[model samples]
Target: MIELNWEGVYPAVLTPFKENGDIDFEMFAKNTEAQIKAGVHGIIIAGSLGDAAVLEMDEKFELLTFTIKVVNGRVPVILNIAENTTKNAVNFAVKAKQLGADGLMLLPPMRYKADDREAVEYFKAVANATDLPILIYNNPVDYPVFVSLAMFEELQLCPTIKAVKESTRDLTNITRMKNRFRDRYKILAGVDTISLEALAVGADGWVFGLVDAFPKETVAMYNHVKNGEFAKALELYRWFMPLLELDIHPKLIQYIKLAATAEGISTPYLRAPRLPLVGEEAERINKVIADGIASRPKLD
Candidate 1:
């Protein structure tokens, strides 16, 4: 089993697709390589950002296998499990480990908003099913299921559950988790808008979205904070705010893909139920990327 440090920048990457909706492996590799080259500490594949709900199991496994080869042990590749059933989630976890995944980013059971007991049981079942270290994706704002402090206390019984992605959109929870758990679970900031604050307040790491487009800038912000260069980090964060806000929207995949396109690292193609951005929305998002690029900071 790979040791996951559960710290530093980890991008939940976009799944590049052709206009015909086919997975574009070439573009996928380019973006993944860019993240690795930019010094991101880890990579997450097929999460909410990666269009996991739309991808078939075979495609996810193929992505997992291909990413492991492309990453070549340069950084850990963690797969996101968003299944709606404990059985399916456990099955995927076991297979992910078998396929060489270094860790997992597990969401609460999908579609059905499980209550506290149901959610804890779901998480425990997955944790017991495999030895892969799990990062609980606690995004109640989007996922509709909140993993409360009480719930986490029960989840502590599963030693394989190692971390929590704090996406409740409340920065105070970072303090709450630290005060309560005291390092039992590594806390990573999942919301881009408050990431710097989360880090300043002592989040172990950030699982970011815009890093898929602006890898260097994202990693630089993280390094700046870690090095105690608050002024420089805040400078970069202010510039990044517009693009970072894109990650919180319902069509974040489209917005981030457009940003990645401007950087020449990705194309703006997406599978349906999700279409390419058009008209006013497209023009506005394009300008945000353009302006950000025109004024991008010089980092060491």
Candidate 2:
């Protein structure tokens, strides 16, 4: 199993697409380069922010392979597994390791809303199938099943499950997890809006969304907080709140892609049933992105 310190900012990357709906590998590489250049600790592909549900299995593998090549080990590349069944999840986990994924952000059974036993068993089954380290994604606000701390007590028995992407959105859970487990699990702040607070309260890392577009600002915030420059971090965070709030919207993929486009990193092409933002929505989001770029903070 690969040893990951699992510390620092890891962006849940946006999957860039062409106008005709094909995966835009060129733009994808450009986006990856921006993250690497900004000194992000790692990158996550095929995540909720990346529109993983709409991607086919082959596309997922292709993105993972392509990302590894583009990254070239400059930073660790983690894949998100959103499978609905234990069997398929295990198969994908095995394949991800074989295809050179550094680690995984594993989600609970999709659509079924697995009970505590089923969720625990599902996670254990995947852990047993692979040697890859796992960050169990615990986002109850968006995903139906929430992996509670008690469930994590059971998961601790699985040695490879190393981290938690804590997007439960309750700030106290950060304190609760640390108080309960100590350093047993690395806690990554998964939601963007409250990320500074998460870092202030002792999250080990951030699994970010808007960082897909604003890598430098994201990395700056984390670095400031880590370096005990709380005032600097707060200054950036206050400026960053409007853009960070985009991560929580239902159409975040479109909104974030547009934000990236505004910054000249990625194009705003989304796969269907998901459409491009238009009219009032487009103008509104564009203004937010434009205003953010215009007033982007200058850090020293």
Candidate 3:
């Protein structure tokens, strides 16, 4: 298959839930349409931002299938197929290819945390499972047992590992990996807060949940960075700091959904064991979102 270019703004599509806490497939489609209409580069379905861990395999397949059908090849649809086991991740990777997914954004296994070599073998196994390309989701905060900089460099040399979302605050690692494997791998800025900086240091682009709430603003920010308008991008990125801060949290799905509800697009419902934000928690989050919106730069 052709090499994947996960370059530019890709929104981690949210899994919309109805009032009864069921998957609102219709709303999910509408929201996806909105992103496409707004000119996002690609769509990442069933990610952490989509609350994928709680979703059943059937639900994940349905969402991926629906996304591919609706997107209709207008833009690439990359599935976020992640699990703790190599077998499960490999199975999902195989399924994603069958559904015609363009690529994958994979999170490292979190439970009990595996050792370094075991982790490397996990990704290599997934890569070998299917012809579909993979992008490492380097979210160290949530998945504490992250791939080391050495391991990432090693994966970069592997042909099937197409891209990487470098979430670590250590810009050093990004620079190191890019210097060594810039020709083979695309380094996507996984942290919204550091997109501009990462972009400056040779990052290809971003796989962002921030784009979920403010597509135009996020697009503008990336464009500004691309155009070397550091001052303007910095201005915009700071204006978006509140939403940026929420991204590193494990409950980003909850607050982001609430923010969407405040935007009147969807309700803030979440699946079992993962409660929706409420009371003072939601009140505080609402304030941040409202404040950000108030200060958000004009879209048009």
Using lDDT as the measure, which candidate wins? 1
Give TM-scores for every candidate, taking all chains together and pairing residue i with residue i: 0.99, 0.98, 0.93
Tens digits of per-residue lDDT, candidate 2, 1-300, equal 335888999999999999988999999999999998999998899999998989999999999999998888788989999999899999999999999999999999999989999999999999999989999999988998889989999999999999999999999999999999999999999999999999889999999999999999999999999999999999999999999999998999999999998888898888889998889988898888899999999978
| C-alpha lDDT of all candidate models, in order | 0.94, 0.93, 0.80
Which residue pairs collide in model 1, if any?
none
- lDDT by residue for model 3 (249-279), tens: 7778887887776665556788888886778
CA shift at 175, candidate 1, in angstroms?
0.5
Instruction: Give the better candidate number (1 or 3) by lDDT.
Output: 1
Q: Tell me the lDDT of model 1 at 256.
A: 96
Per-residue alpha-carbon lDDT of candidate 1 for residues 1-300, written as tens digits (9 for 90 to 100): 457989999999999998888899899999999999999999999999999989999999999999999999999999999998999999999999999999999999999989999999999999999999999999989999999999999999999999999999998898998999999999989999999999988899999999999999999999999999989999999999998999999999999999999898988998888887889988998899899999998987
Each prediction's RMSD to truth: 0.8, 0.9, 1.9
Q: What residue runs in model 3 are displaced by over 4 Å at the alpha carbon?
A: 1-3
Worst 10 residues of 3 by lDDT: 1-10
